[model samples]
Target: MHSLRNTRLPFKVSLSLLSLSLILPIQTSGLLFKPLTLPPSHPLSLQSYQPLTSATTTTTITTNNTTPSPLTLSTNMTLFYPAETAPHKATILGFPSTHAVPRDLLNQTRNEIMDLAVVISEFEPVRVHVRPEDESLARRILNERFQKLEDINNNNNNNNNNRTKKAKAKRFNLLNRRTRDNNSKEDDIPQYHLDRITFHPCPTNHPWVRDTAPVYVLDKSNPAHRIAIDFGFCEWGGKNLREINVRNEPLGLEADGEDERSPVSSRKGYAAPDNRHWENARFAKRVLEREFDLDEQAENNEIKVERVVSPLRLEGGALEVDGEGTFLATESSIICPHRNPSSSLTTREAIESHLRALLGVTKIIWFPGRKGLDITDCHVDGEVKFIEPGLVVQNKPHPKTGKAEMEIYKEIKEILGRETDAQGRKIRVVELEAADPDLVGWGGDYDEGGEEELEKEQEEAAGTYVNFYFVNGGLIVPAFGDQKRDRKAVETLRGLISPERKIRQVYVSALPLMGGVVHCVTQQVI
Candidate 1:
């Protein structure tokens, strides 16, 4: 059983992100929104950065950044949605709990998170929202990771005792971005990078903060200012609300065809009593509304953050913004019956208008994303990512993948070939191949017929490389144990992205099994 110790530390609570399992339903594409004069495009590279002590603390990581040009949009624009590559004050992730990672996979989940947190902290500070009960366990896990690193360093030092000082120093300062820590020896993640990690005691139903957390947008009025859009979540159509080990409630139903399935069937992610993920939704709002109960920073240094409440319900993983004015999303993830489930929000125009009002979105490049595929109904993050406005990367499925999955990627390529972005720039699409499913080995953990739902659902997240997270000066990508493909992924991203930004892969096994990856679990506060 998972520990529920009552020891309470100084609580700092802010939480978000969710992943749901469901089938995919194809929708029509091509809804080009009218153009709007948006904020100028800028490259994200930080000469300097401020540590994130609160959610509202604003920071910029833009190179040769420019102010927003005057806008002629339908809505009076204030909040500017920066691209994922934009400078981030900090990145937030939730520590996996009982139901999210399952009991048997808890150790693997924690280890994966440990690898992610430590490596990410090498680039920027990380905020981990750990439930109060799991605080000590989380700390222990990190400390163990730190000690393991120290041992490895010690071994290296012993082996290369006669190495020259200059060679050692050169080997130590690898990226040349982070200055050496004077206090620590060799500066090799001294103290497991624990100094860069801050823990917040909070409640979380699921740990995919990309879906549950606030989608931050920079304010055009003030570049140092930010707005947190709480695009309310419904547990990915409430399909993933069920805890692990919960059996799929039988409804005397079976699949009719690929395009059709019973909505109430609970076969994908299992059925829970209700979503009950409202705590995470409320957590999103509290960040903007309340005083930082644990904020230690001075008042003058804090960046101003504004909040805009919206009726739209979607996860951060569903929408990909170019940090200009264009938006990309799966149609089923946003406008379907579950997310925008109201008479007023039914139409495409209505949903687009709300997006415009909320984030000043000018053009929406819609893909016929299949609904009920994985926990996200085919979240766009799993398929495509905007390197900037014009340049983007997509996941090309393994050749052995199902016809349904292959067709989806083919459509994405076709759309990119035809469509223009919000700023009238033709999009450039790069294809990144996913790891072969047969080659992805999850070392005999799950019970036979345990969590593997169905053949179609399993193929959705079979080592997808696009679901990666962006830190301040780094990209956190998943490694699916395929050495060749994993190495190829790093090389590809390095060639495509900024030279200063490093591409690091964290070996992920359990989350991908649950239909999520690095991007699903992490959120950036810009």
Candidate 2:
């Protein structure tokens, strides 16, 4: 563990941060967290072993394909961060088994993810990860979905061809008539690119890749170089405890099925049958190693992957970064004692220092995230997202949750309005309205769960459209069943994004039922 070096911050900048340190002060009083005592049985503590092996000890395996072999990093790897709107090499997504998920809503969630993958493929390459047994199921769904889309496109293309032929025959008429373009009308509409999407076998505990998967970054020393940041994840502050406990039972065999488990599940992070939460993190790294290896080999085999390991227990969803230097996060998720105990991070300065070194952030804005409001402890991804360097998009409060839940949004907007970006430009905030109540409870009734589980679904069903991903030339956004609100969201996004970007929307009602939306399941490689 000592072999993995901590990244050093620049001397001049370190002095600057020390002199201009800013704390939450009285503005975030109740949010000030105290250290927590870890349960005796809990595997996580300040000194607990990391979920994955030391970077130096990571195994190197060669695939039969032309791809480069997975490499290891004994020292810290400084990574180059890219803005969310930057061009992406590819996007990674995951799908859970129907057995692991509630059977009643399995089809809904599966179709939503499939639809999301298909739509995103139209813009940039997409990779869908599934458990080994579910690989065929994923392929079948995507194939059938794309085939239908292809048939429609073919029919439309035939009609367009006929129109073009008729116009071509009358050369003088074509000159008199507005010169018709040869391209089909569907050219304006993004057609699904089946070739752009590839399915891979990657067994995961859940489908939320944004949290568990390795965050991609470029090497600062070499722009062509790529790095994978394996920041340790503890299953969203150990919210997976219930799921892990249930899986340890005998009846659990019937619930999730034995086929879903991966060989990586036997690692140190998953040694304890009672808490298999960290298994997701371990398996995610394995999947990313393969992705990085293949992508690098396909581009430049000389460029090797540099792995960076961090001991911090945080989820990618908890913090939002504008590729430049500004970072947005909630105190309850990162600064909270539950995730970053004093024994580990020690002080706010120490925590911020870690973030600055790892994320290359200059300023971190902290908000008092409502504790227990959602599983992620009010992750900023749900409330705030950066469209560009100085432009931000925030979620509107749910109609059912009312104004009380909206106070946070108002506070954040007010503060951001006064703040400036790395280039010293005042932030421009855009508000994305909430989903209608009628669409909130669309899929909750199908699941026969306990009152507590049902209540959680009700609270999360109407997730805002703010949680969206920015691809190369397009925006992948969530579309709730509410016809009016969905269209409004697309219109609002068009106003916020540049006119050149293609906006693609998918019906993602099932995501809210599981406590996340579009952005939660996708992570882009820069």
Candidate 3:
């Protein structure tokens, strides 16, 4: 169990004195004595009292550099989140665990997982805990989720609810079948069954854990301290083709005329597929508990993990903070019309408020982002990161290829130059060129269904290197196999990081097909 203690001490200040009598020049003043007619005092009352005066005055002085002989302050520390200096803490990762990716990609992801596990274990004992839907908490969350889904279904159903008897029967049968299947699974599945995996059964199935997972932060003033910031995530703000994008096509949908089953009907369908969200949450909880060394009985049996929810929907990928007080973010994702249409907070206001409340931060440095582009609009991490206080590493636009994006980069540089932190410290921006542009097709297909479809496809096809993830002791930078640019990127990052931190490259060829990269797939918990 964690223990607490206190200490106390005293300090003294030095004093100096000088005599005014010795420093002043001699002066003579008239001395006169006058006695008015008064009654004579008795011998006992005639004693004289002298007035008090000081020729010398003492001055007490304090210096900023003066070292106090003894001082006391409580120091409480924990290794819950791995320090950048420490090589042992495993970097938590949120992968694009989509089933649509090629089988080889899955194998590679598995390998990467094992590699990360080994690295973390070498530093300290590691436990891989997947998130499980807490049945106790399920009722509340499920009720809320079901309400939302029902609203959407009802809205879509519109006035069809009061249709003729025959039509009502058909709809009833379909609804009844779905309901029965769901009920059976719920009854058969044991709450405590360790083997069972559950998915977040929300209709907005953009279950990308990295985009939605809570960002954990430690409170410097408190002992046994940690907090989770839930960043709001959208479905990449509707970048991919809603229906035709094969990579993004929902699971359980089969060919036109096959014996395909709805996910609701399959035992392993939805549960096994979207387990990443639950897994991440569970892993995060365990890490916090173990790191703080809380009393097992009290923490496990009594105290629940406390969370501070930020209404401002921010994904960790969109935010990059220096270990210090400053954070870097872009205006695009935070303020995009696509993410929050009715939000009262503007881009600047939302950022300032969010930083102050969530990060205990006073200032947020913003760069005018590439707007009206792909998903996430433009996450700040794709543009710049705070490598250290007052210093940044930015993704430079390619001079020859990204002509338009280069203009955006120039604007970003200008903005960064004018901005300062809350402490009035100027930010130093560094530039690194973006990866080479690939020949991407609209939704990875040559044909466009219509003029509107063509425009949408073009927007989704733009390739970006800004979406990169920084892993534990390494950077999982995305590479599109453009040899020249890829090599330069690797070299640029290696120069900034230490030799101990490996620069591992992950080739995400399939990202452009759906319109994002590695950073989109992972969110870092600070």
What TM-scores do the predictions have? 0.70, 0.72, 0.52
Give all candidates' CA lDDT scores.
Answer: 0.58, 0.57, 0.38
Task: Give the per-residue lDDT digits (tens) of candidate 1, residues 264-366.
Answer: 2221121112223235544555443322333345274343554544545677887789878999887867876555433445567767765765676789999
Query: What TM-score does candidate 1 reach?
Result: 0.70
lDDT of 3 by residue, 483-502 (tens): 45555666666666655555
lDDT of 1 at 358: 62
Residue 475 lDDT, candidate 1, scale 0-100? 75
Model 2 lDDT per residue over 324-375, tens place: 8888887767875454332435356657766776676787888787664556
Lowest-sum lDDT 10-residue window in model 1: 1-10
Better of 1 and 2 by TM-score: 2
The pairs that clash in candidate 3 are 130-279, 131-278, 131-279, 396-432
Number of the candidate with higher lDDT, 1 or 2: 1
Lowest lDDT sum, 10 consecutive residues, model 3, at: 1-10
